[model samples]
Target: MKRLIAYIMLALSLAACKKQNVKDTGPTTVVTPPVTGIIDTSRTSWWQKAKFGMFIHWGVYSVPAGIYNGVDISDPGSGHYGSGEWIMHNLQIPVASYKEFAKQFNPTAYNPEEWVQLAKDAGMKYIVFTAKHHDGFAMYDTKYSDWNVVKATPYGKDVLRPLVDACRKYGLKIGIYYSQANDWINKGAANGGFWDVAQNGSMDDYIDKIAIPQVRELLSNYGDVLEIWWDIPDEMTTARAAKFSPVLALQPRTLTNNRLNQNWTGGDFDTPEQNITASSGGRPWESCMTMNDSWGYTKNDKNFKSSSTIIRNLIKVASLGGNYLLNVGPDANGKIPQPEISILKDLAGWMRINSESIYDTYASPFKFTPWGNATTKLTADGNTNIYLHIFNWPGGEKLHVPGVKNQLLSASMLANGKSVNGINDDTGITLDIPVGPVDNISSVIKMVVKGKLQVEVYEQGPEANGSFILSAAAADLHNPNGWDDIHVENEGNPNLGYWTNPWAYATWKIAVKTPGIYKVQAEIATEAGATVMVASVNGEAVQKTLTSTGGYGSYRLVTLGNLKIANSGSVTFTLAPDPGNWQPVNVRKVILTP
Candidate 1:
């Protein structure tokens, strides 16, 4: 009986060993990766397909075109005392200024079809026309206000109506930019209106009599508004916004921006003006920037961003999982400036070739590095693809990437459809970029992973050479609060001192979980008497130093070599001041690309 039992136990043990060996030989099972963050995928529904769009800033402001009373009136700096868009109001030019403009605003060559055709040729998928600017003059016909294009102009036409119709006919989505803060016309309505003139009128009465009624007219007149770009409602309170939320019911799916109220009570998305933020995981965001320095038509404003600059900005925004709405200011004749049109066409051409990296894409699992930007998208089968945008290629055939550990399926350039080789290791992935510089603009490399990509970032201190930190102050500067934090001193003020003569100093302690090459960058300003500024790691002086002059400075990227850190390693950063008391320093942002 004992011998029989021993035989049975031996058989059972053999069987278990065989099962374990079989499991080791078979393919490994992969668990489904977690979604990074919840994004209203619906917000991407429209913008993803419509990869590129045009913003037309045409309004009564265009009529003045930065002039008043036969004189070129500039904004506050140029000896004008009003918002550039409010020149007529600041100079109190009265109805005469507008009347004269009306006579010359005939726009005899204005053809809606021609405009739409030009946009289509340029590859714009949508158009956002200014229905009303700060001037309070409506471009569309509205029963609620007599100060509209149909009633106030010699042309006596609803300018926006034909544009909308033409856009729809040409397969373009239509968006409207509405000035919720009325300037000249509806001043008595709701919280003193645009010019902030407090009249003895009830807020509700003004909203009911003018604001809401005009909004209702717009929704009813337009076929279907995809977005409502509201601007400059500084006086609007949360209660006021709640009262106005019902207006959105007229067009339920329409997207709204955060500018309508101080608190952004009913905004569908956060609007970052002229700047893009690092990804908030999966938060929805849009960057609205003007073609020129000014939002409205300014004849003397020659500060237009170049075509390449605009395209780069768009890509940067997209890489951070945000949309870009580039603006254009038309002349008084209702014609887009030739220069602006040229830039848009160039952007459109680029989008046609490389938009796959942008449209329908999400923020990459890897953080943005000094080498360039990065973005990611998911395939239909749930496989994930990452795109690396290299604006300043390292000029080498091979490039190393850290913090990625997934199996790579393929690597290729999205522009030319050329395949590239890559090496995958436990630390990260490395790809062989094209041997030579292909173009002056940025190039994208696509990396397909078997499943979702996972990565975490750690910072090491100055003592641990090559470690970095993105200070709280730098993060706060990019907050939606406002551009008030854009000053030179505020750039890296709270964390790293400005690169000025009087060197202000700050100490940063960073902890790193792994050892790797890390890159550091800071936004610094230069003023008179400013000399070279230095940064040191762990009391060891860094070789790279930045020199500045008296002006708005550019971002200086500092490459700290590979750092070796075990678990719980820490490092510190120190800044040395230049000789001078000049407070001509600012440090806006600091990036630690590990």
Candidate 2:
């Protein structure tokens, strides 16, 4: 018996040796495909290349920084010093009461070159500063109104001009954030009437006389403005939007946010506040998020998101073919808080190593994995490169991709030039992921493929039965329903969110106010023969499961059991394969209805 055992051990050792020899033989060598087309050089593409930018929310609000007359005037509802400097407008503080802030608003140490240089050092390609905030105070020297930094304060300097000049000196693009709506001094605007008791005048005349001319001055004086970041155009009419459209005629290339008019006709791109949309694939979109809680400088605001979170957020936005406009509010003394500076420097270090994956890259063609997120961009040679952004590294050293038909040429870590080994099969692509926390922030994996991008989609159920219609291949589930096509979020982390094909997943969290027999359906396509899906309610596993049989598959009207959700309770739906091997599954819609 001992001899027999020894023989078996010898056989096992020989087998292991044989396998090692096969691996040592090395991967197959194949010629790469020829280049197809040049990159689209439209205005949209230029903006997309600018994956990361800086947003500065500075103005009269910096003077207050959440304090008025030695009293903490922070708003309790939204928090953070009553939206920075807008507290005066929001609280309806009388002009006489608020005018006192202008006296101490003298920023003696303010240097536009220092600020713009800091942004350039951080690898930011663009800078967007607040020219006029909701408080009706213009940061630039404007001919239209007396309520401006150049006219109202003791330090009567045109802040915007110097900043613009500094940006040009550093070879960075410059933009302006104008709050055309909710101006406190422009009586023609409806919200401006809040300060009516201070000045007696006609509102319409105030808008025509004060607001329009100020806008013209901003467009004419600023040299080669790249964008106009408009905000909160609530209750604005088409006529008002039409009035603003001509201003852009002055600079046809100037990109504007959707907020220029509530109708969204004037803006060049859809601006989603604080979030990225899933459906922004092959479209223009920007995510404007504040560093802390408010856009303007706020004192005693400690709720700033960690640098890791901010970096992850930027990666997600970039992965989905969207730009991230990160904001920073300087204190009343015109100094960026120490914490913000540290965060920016750290982010710049990270960008220095992994910028190739972000800068000048378009969206990826692969679907977002349940455990991670991916973005694809075509190289100059026309070969598509997919970047896998791992937010939460799995415990194991292997990543299992369900469906991929194209042969992989190479795989490497974006941070360090380390080669990764894996297997490619019809079942899926399984790569050896590095073990033990790779980075403090997210890590990117670049996968070079040989052929045109292809993907298979799977649906939870049928559309006719109960599934919501999936519009774009990519949609952001976290944003409001109509906003999915406008912004892109969930960029780098695959496990956190979902999008359509070539777009990240936009899953919906539907609340059942009234419970009844509801139909749940989804539209999906997959490359494999069969795929499985599971649904659950409040952590309780549901018995029903949907299956797809063939390529480019879908399901409709998969009825869920009668649900009785209490008013306070919530329901969640998730999708995955049964055998757990599926790739590039495009989920178009998930509809729930009685």
Candidate 3:
């Protein structure tokens, strides 16, 4: 629901982003600059280890089930297009009309134990359920408002307490998803509405009388809340955000996400929606993705992601040291979509065999791999365990791994525990790949390394076509003076630019097989006169004087003289300015073709 709103806001702000450096204006509100807070590792250790969880966006939105007044929620002809949860805002449904759906919101078939069991069987470490959403409808029995399930709905019961109990009974942690702002039904609350006169009330009054008290009720009543999932801080200022901090302080160990208020700096983790965002150094993060196109249950939404994609996404997130909070939206009758259940069953089967590679794993040591991703962990015996999640099994007998400097102790298939052979060299190691993948979806190859994990930077070998591409994005920059301007950038494209320092250089480790004469071409852009650079390999060198290719951003591939290689082995390749006659140049990549 918040994800859909975010995309719309991004589209509307694209022009401003192109004109100047623009920051994210979250849901019609200005986001203050981020504040840094001391991160307590002790408070986050359990969450970091729990790399996967379940997200439930169940709400009264399920009552409409993506249809309102005989029109589809996303019907283009009706001029409405958004997620099921945003039906009220997108279709401009009045608060009075929207409240009528609450009368029909019944979940008699909702079995808390069944939901918890499904999550546990799917190998999820925790479950985060929607307690309240943007429509100002609470799934729980909040004393502050009659716009709650217990007082308004036919089912007339609190949904959260039983879910929490079930999670505890099944030894799984539970969290609550609360929308602290943009309550459409509450008078004076900030909301996306012009027609609903009932929504005209003081924002501060809504926060004090409704949002804050409800938050306090949720945190205090729910025993041992694992996380506090706040969404869409539309008009929540820092002062308003601070009101909930004391309520959260009651449960000191409960984790909170960044969306409570973008200005608030005391979040335990970042919540990146619908995408596997890159790791922010070692900061805790989670990607909340849906099983299909919608976060809330849409009866007509059948755009379900494949089981393979879901599995690989989980692996990809774990490899990057983040959690995957996969979502499932239950219908009004409390039945999960059939396709979602089937996907969960598939995940259950896969996790039953390959979960050891995921749990408590650190980020990959290598920068990138052709086949798939990797995760590592330090063993109790002082060794390192590298779990290779292979999406594309190699056709040849050998599966190459670059940049690794550790000695391989043992290799085995995690699925069946069968021994695999590994051959080591200075460049990296190669695993004797099996005839076929043990599991076709994604095979986990576990390799134990001796001592601490050591990986050489910017090391690579030839692709299947026997061509070596030393890209500037992967180059190891050497700045002896510590103020060298030479660095990789993406101005027009990804290239090494701002080469003002003559002493600084870039290098790559290449493992050459089937040694022979290879054609070398460099993609460089420069306006300086007759810039000379020395490209060197094991005792052999090529000194080339390059001509201008129009401008610094206008790149052209110019052929550089090739040198002979005496042997087929790993060697260092260096590109440095010719000391006496050096000029600035932007380098994209150097290609060696045999």
The whole-model lDDT of each prediction reads: 0.61, 0.62, 0.78
| Better model by TM-score: candidate 2 vs candidate 3 | 3
Model 1 has an lDDT value of: 0.61
| Cα TM-score of candidate 1 | 0.75
Cα lDDT tens digits for candidate 2, 361-474: 755433335455566677777566877778778879988654455677888888787998877875446889788546757688888877665433322222444333323322
Error at 103, model 2, angstroms = 1.5
Tens digits of per-residue lDDT, candidate 3, 342-426, equal 9999999999999989888887765557677888877999998999999888988788876566789999999989999998885
Cα error, residue 580 of model 2, in Å, equals 40
lDDT of 1 by residue, 306-394 (tens): 77777777777676556777777777777778888788678667767777787767654443354666777788887888888777788
TM-score winner among the candidates?
1
Q: After the best TM-score superposition of candidate 2, give how far the Cα of residue 129 lies from its true spot, in angstroms.
A: 0.9
Misplaced by over 4 Å in model 2 are 1-41, 69-81, 190-195, 279-282, 458-594
